[model samples]
Target chain A: MTSQLFSHDVQHTLDIAGIFVFALSGGLLAVRKNLDIFGIAMLAEATGLGGGVLRDLIIGAVPPAAFTDIGYFITPLAAAVVVFFLHPEVERINWTVQSLDALGLGLFAVTGTAKAHDYGLGAVASVALGVATAVGGGVIRDVLANEVPSLLRWDREIYAVPALAAAILVAVLIAAHALGPVTGTGAALVAFALRMLALRYGWR
Target chain B: MTSQLFSHDVQHTLDIAGIFVFALSGGLLAVRKNLDIFGIAMLAEATGLGGGVLRDLIIGAVPPAAFTDIGYFITPLAAAVVVFFLHPEVERINWTVQSLDALGLGLFAVTGTAKAHDYGLGAVASVALGVATAVGGGVIRDVLANEVPSLLRWDREIYAVPALAAAILVAVLIAAHALGPVTGTGAALVAFALRMLALRYGWR
Candidate 1:
């Protein structure tokens, strides 16, 4: 029971970290769009929780974890507050933001797939949800900002592709009865490397 | 049991009609935005179902009726096909579209509120979700087209306000144990008239 509890804590910690980075990116976008504090907070909350909310909703998880947990609810606001006060510094560290975003993407993609599988979805559906979980928040952010989502742009560098690969890896592992911590880590690492490489090469 | 079944059928039919009109508006927006055929279909689907999908997710309704019902899935595509072929005619009939949209909004707001009440959401949250069900699709449509949602624009005439009023009325009725077909229809009519008045008088 203690071992199980420890694993649960680790998962929760990772989930919160991913949400923070995603929220930071969202808050930064709100700043760039010249949105007021309310808008910044709204965008941050949406970006951090939108994907998971979507996933949970589709899987019949009511009230959503974000709504139930005060910590989850407040973390994105904290990110938004930081962006509101230090946007210029945030902008200056674009590389750091991008790196964090990549990490979030990798983590979400695998976790989303695993959760979908737990919910009894097929591999294809799980993969789709996984990608949605990874990128859905950004789509919501861009939409609220009245801009084309970078994910759907023809000229945008590869983003969803790497996430898709990670989701697929997790799904395949589950199918082969080989899903475990090592494989999950390997899947995330692969997606992270691909995202970083795409960023470095300006892959379109 | 038979009466309950009959009311359910009536509600279902009304919901489908609302979705059709909403989908038509989404398809028209895609055409105006110069998106391709695929984009048109996607936008149509998103606009038609986005609200209910969000509502269902929040209420813990799994798989979403939109995904489960074949008619719901196909209606938007059909609307997209029509818009693609007769966009000029659709443009010419913009007033008709607007009127239908108003009708759809009223119907959706009341139905959404009732559904939320059935799902055990409190009055305040139910009213919020009701407005969301009425306006969420259009917001998604605008966002995908890279435009500010007219519903959120300060200059735009009243849209969500009338829906909110209707939703509030439903909540009050539910609270008073007076919710019925008469009250529901009356609420919708009130909202519908308000919307039309706003359009005609250019209410800001």
Candidate 2:
């Protein structure tokens, strides 16, 4: 009885895709911090899986997808391997990384909200979880790297706002019983577009 | 049908006590960092409940005890209030603070292991979760304060070792069918004593 907006397979794909991109950011940060390979791999895994793990725990999803799904566990390692061998090339494409990160943020926000709602959480709580799913891993990465969480810092480009907006849109669409694939994708696109615009315009 | 080692009421009481002490430490740090009142309260709550919340989430406890239990929610705020007006005096009593923190470390280790075991996790995973329950809040507090986690910093006094030892002992006792109230209390005391001795001897 899965809703169209909650296309289970598509959501899984996006979740894994987002995790890979986030892991790349984490790996890049670990390299910049002069961490060894182990540290890099650990950061990659933590950054990629931390948010989803947190969200799963809060929703009472035991063992978490990170622990249960081999793909979820291995994707970060793959990202780490990629980063370790070609970090110099990876670092040169900061814009590309940011764009992918925005996409990750958007996908996580929409999917996370949908999943939370599926678990019978109220809309507001679902939206909050969605934002957490979008940004939680980066917070863990910063903590491990001894940096202040960008989510809490005012100097960073507006990150959580777009996620919050996208999550809320999904919640609204769900409440209105109109959360088909088109609107769901639209909600994610809104986050991506807003984030890209913020990056381009140097918003906050 | 609770086991002697898993006395539910006693566990809840210890959890609340540990949370309060942890919150005091968090509030003290916030005060030192010149955070405002709201920030102080937030830190207090986060520091007090963060570890337990993490444990609960991993073990499939929904909503978290922090959210479901009024006392769990309020104890940290009370600690924050105490810290707000009396931080100077509180800081002067660092020995007392360390002692309470050690006791918290011990209680959380023992109780966390028991809870995870009750949830059917294997002994090793239960022990790991126990240590996490003991130290996770401090890590969160330090991270939010923009300090490197004392857990990861070797320069700090030995911390995780005692918690780990306590948790392992509890797991072993459970496996041996000897984890009654007496042995459970003894396990907690081991962590407390180890931490105290470490502080006294400047174990790093």
Candidate 3:
């Protein structure tokens, strides 16, 4: 409400960027599952947009942006196409994909929080939605691929924590009327760093 | 509209009844998974409400009835309790549960389609939403429980087919100006009978 977090343009671009990387992960998983092309695309779209779509539905944003925005809808399909032909190469670059995925998680957590806040959800609910938005795609991907949600499995290294923390931080910043582009970027970076560190050190 | 399909009251009641049976399936799966009470409750709610929630979101019904209606929200919790305390007994009555589940599928298919139509969707989209509402919970339950969705598994008896057929029939009835309580009942009965026959005759 004050100066805002990310500019509308930056947020839109980042959202699409996040979808691209997340869809890559999903499409790669479909390859591992030996699914057909349709299956690969299904996983791509679900993994890329499931989180945001779920948040929008819960917060009363009808006809979610995934349906309305051609870019958002098409980016994941493009990723699917990329993986359809280059899965072996994509698989070879797993670390790079993971790094990009971490960035997507961070960006989505903060942006999703801001959007949920804009929709008038309370702080706790907003943070919850933010964390959900960050982790939802992966959960959907795993579920569709017939695996337990890695995000929820206790044996898995911590994943949702970083998003949760980032969302909480964003909520606090909002409460203080101190959320702006700089703080938002810092917040996202905090999430990214937490996720990378968790991966490296094997948190939980 | 030519005098419509169902009274809102009947639709509301049938919707809750469907939630009860679907939630039972979810609760049973959670028990099989050895999940704790919280997991049981989570699966129950997800299974009971996931489909309707998905449809509502797509059709622009914000804060879906699952959240707004206390009955819709609590019925699944009640189902979880039934499964929690009497799982062994419930399992013993598996055929009964399956039969009731088939009935729920039929009811939800018609009701979900009708609701989607009321929201001003086209016939195709309405039927699709109806089918989603009928099958959505089981998909979520299976996904959450980390198993392949039975509805999508080729080896399983034809599950989604019945719902799809019912929804299509409802759409036809709507188009023909013949959808009233009598025809609506006939459509739901058609779905239920088809599902039962499929299970009985090993249709897949």
Candidate 4:
């Protein structure tokens, strides 16, 4: 039971980190829009927690992580406050943020697929939820920023496709009972590299 | 069953009207942000359908209204397009837009309560969903506009409260087997009047 709890905590930590990166993206965009700190915080919270809350509620998890976990809620708030104070530095090192975002997307894609499967969803539905989890936050962030959702825009290169690949990897591993440490890390590495490559080469 | 379907259709029509008003509000706000047509359309869609889509998905409705009903998606697009072309008219009588917003809020509150009941949710949960439905679009709109969510702010008076009252009124009447022209219209009227008065006198 302690081992089980430890694993759950590890997964939750990854999810929280993913949400933080997503929130940072939203907060930075809010700054670009010349929003105040409060506005930045709101956008961060919306982009970071919105999709997970939606997914949890749909899956019959009540109260949502936004309401149940102060840690999750505070993570975005802290990220916003940091971005609030360090706008210039943030703007200068946006590349670092992008790298962290790619890492988050990969981890979150795996987490989402695994979570959906844990919720007893079939592999297909699990993969779909994984994609939703990975990209949903960004879609919402773009929509809130009053831009066409990058996910929906035809001009954007291979955004959702990388998330899909990650989800497929997890689904295949879980199906084969081969989601060992090496395989799990390999799957995440594949997703992270693919996303980074997509950003690098403008690959569609 | 025919009566039920008829009532559903009527509710759908009212929902369409609500979506129209909600879209108008979003479009106007996006204009204030100096966003382009695509940006305006994104805001309009977020404001018009975000709440209902959230409510439906929370209740395990798949694809969501904006995805399942082409009209729900198209309505906001059309409204945004109209606003893009007729900015002068929209600017001239913003008061009319506020009034329409009140009407939409009332309609959505009632419809959300009704739908929640149809799903056999408890009265409390139904009321929660109703409030969310009435305010969800605006929340999304404000988030996109980079403003603090009006519903969450104490400065906004009687937004969710009036919608809650309206939803409770409907739920009570339906429970009492006395839901008719009197209770239905009375609930909607009460909600609308409260919202209008809030708008006029600054009920916050």
Candidate 5:
């Protein structure tokens, strides 16, 4: 169970990347909702960091990394700007946005699970927190937009399930002392593939 | 500056009362939204404990009191049950509910501010967290119900302001070495009266 499979720098980079992708999705939603620039920025920040904030809080991490890291705080605003300028073009490329969102979900699920484990939570709680970290932001965004959370809707695609699967697999691998870059990648890939498959097949 | 003005038993009782009142509001909303029993219970719990959970997380308190204390966990469910059975009557007494809600808000704001101070946060942060603890649950509840949060709506009566006032007062009193049961009670009453006044006059 090597916790340092990826150096801190690499992990931080990936985290930011995930946040950016998630923020883009949130920003696009704000645009669709016809919210003003401030709303777009607000939603982007919430959607990008909500899950991580929730995870950090549950794990007793004070002043969450999202609040402390200037980079993390600014990435969502950058995503909002990009969306504000290119929303029409971005809307046309819905498939691409969704694919990246799936990638973000997978990455966050793995990372969140690992962090929970680092905080000494048991496997079940780690997996639950991982799923929350992956989907919580979207739930918050949808709620703020006065829409039912897609993750909680029966008719929606199987979003949380893939994240849950990834988290569980990661927890199991860690428990078996086989967790490393390969297994981590494997876990994320499994979740990403499942999400993509759900999109393609209209899985509910 | 005495943190022990109220005995632990009394404080616990007050906490449960606050949770009960908040949960009642959530449950009433669930009934109005035509949600099922499960939804009512879920919203009840969310409204009752969301703020405290959020506050605990920010202050690095693990497994917040909501998760650890059986009373906290059950009080919301009890409120849900009462609403499920007597919603028609509850709806008729809307004024009563609103008054109690104001009391809960004031109580939570004071307690939250004091707790934040206990956690060594400065005055500003403590006050901010106090307001969050007072209104965060209702925001979560409104969001889950797919409505613009009353706290964020410009047309609504002032809600957050009273909580903020109470929190600031509590923080100031604590800093001045003048904090005690009297000051705390006075702060809460000021907030409660302000809220009730806002309700009566439709203050936005």
Candidate 6:
């Protein structure tokens, strides 16, 4: 394993950031559901961490990060706490939540692809897993919260597509040995832009 | 690939039955989320069939049942339709939903274990996967619905544990070559009884 390819602190930061956004979405959905604080926290954690845990387990990554890292597990709890108190205000800023969601989706795609590649999977499989991981949490969240998953609906606003693009971008960068901060930023930027445009245009 | 184990019609029936219950749960949650019909159907499909699709993919079961058998996909949609029209009646019978949910959990666990055994995994791994398969959809459903999964919560009745027992029972029967209808039904009954008792006692 190349040190430059996978930095623990870097990955941890990205995962934490992703968890924050996912938990935010989950919390907001709980507000929509009119659930109590406990329900809100539960939803946030499940949405923020469930997909990555599933992906890692399927790939035989032991002690899935959610179990291993207290920080990753607690991030969603913190998010839930914030949302529990500020739910109405949070709902008032739906646009900001949506934007953060897009950013998180992009970051997760890149990180998921990187992790899959580290497990010696081929580029195609890695990218596919990345896409699955990026959206899988929301898919689960929507199903539990009883909304249609934005990714699977015919009216989806390019959710999975952006993840797909981000994964492909990461895989290409890795293949070309050009996956430094510049390319990483470019990949995240591309995914964010695509998702935002999709939202603005109501693209399905 | 044993000819004796291939029961296409039975599998079809079970799939549909499972879809009915699963989609009901998902659709009910969607109603809770206040999503539209499209969102309800989307969640219904995800919660109803996503686990099986995921299991098949992991086991390298090509094309997957969702693709090969139209019924597998259609069942969830049908279920969504039913719930869309009859949610009030269904909601009134919460206990019935819980009972049926336990049944679905038991059946899925057994089937998941059998499938994993067919894929040549060890007993421990197969049982774990079985538990995952049985509860994964519900977990996803909770996350999407923005609620804490009843299974993961400390206060709810024991859910996944009974499914785990059922899977272990089925695995033992299969190993002993005594997994006829009698044994299968016996094991399922045990699971159902355990779940019911737990509910009655408010066991966590």
DockQ of each: 0.23, 0.21, 0.22, 0.09, 0.22, 0.09
Label model 6 with its docking quality class. incorrect
Best by DockQ: 1
Better of 3 and 6 by TM-score: 3
Per-residue alpha-carbon lDDT of model 5 for A42-131, expressed as tens digits? 999999999999888888876899999999999999999999999998889989999989988998999999988887777766776788
- For residue B137, model 5's alpha carbon misses the true position, in angstroms, by 2.1
Clashing pairs in 1: none
**What's the lDDT for residue A183 in model 1?**
78
lDDT of 6 by residue, B1-204 (tens): 411343757655765777678878998888777766666776787788767767776776643455445566677778788778988988999899878877887777777777887888878887887788788888777766667887789988898889889889978887787775567657766777888889999888
Worst 10 residues of 3 chain B by lDDT: B1-10
Model 1 ranges off by over 4 Å: A1-6, A35-42, A81-86, B1-45, B55-60, B66-139, B146-204
For model 4, the superposed segments whose C-alpha errors exceed 4 Å read A1-6, B1-135, B140-204
Q: Residue A153's C-alpha lDDT in candidate 2?
A: 52
TM-score of the second chain in each model?
A: 0.95, 0.97, 0.97, 0.93, 0.97, 0.92
Model 2 Cα lDDT, one tens digit per residue, B30-90: 8877765655776898899999989988887786766556678789989999998899999
Runs in model 5 deviating more than 4 A are: A5-17, A30-46, A53-93, A120-129, A139-155, A158-204, B1-17, B20-24, B27-46, B53-110, B117-132, B143-204
> If scored against the real structure, what TM-score would every candidate get?
0.62, 0.63, 0.62, 0.58, 0.63, 0.58
Model 6 segments beyond 4 Å from truth? Answer: B1-115, B118-204
Chain A of candidate 5: what's the TM-score? 0.97
Ranking of all candidate structures by their lDDT, best first: 2, 5, 3, 1, 4, 6
Residue B65 error, candidate 3, Å: 3.8
Error of 3 at A108 (Å): 7.4
- Per-residue lDDT tens digits for candidate 4, residues B1-204, read 112422667767888989999999899889989999999999999999999997887666666777888889899999899889997899798889888888898878877776776666666666667777998999878876877566645445657768878989877877787666556767877899998898888876
lDDT tens per residue, model 4, A29-145: 888877667668767887888778766765566545554455776789888998999988988898888888888888777777777777788999988998888888888777666
lDDT per model, in order? 0.84, 0.88, 0.87, 0.79, 0.87, 0.78
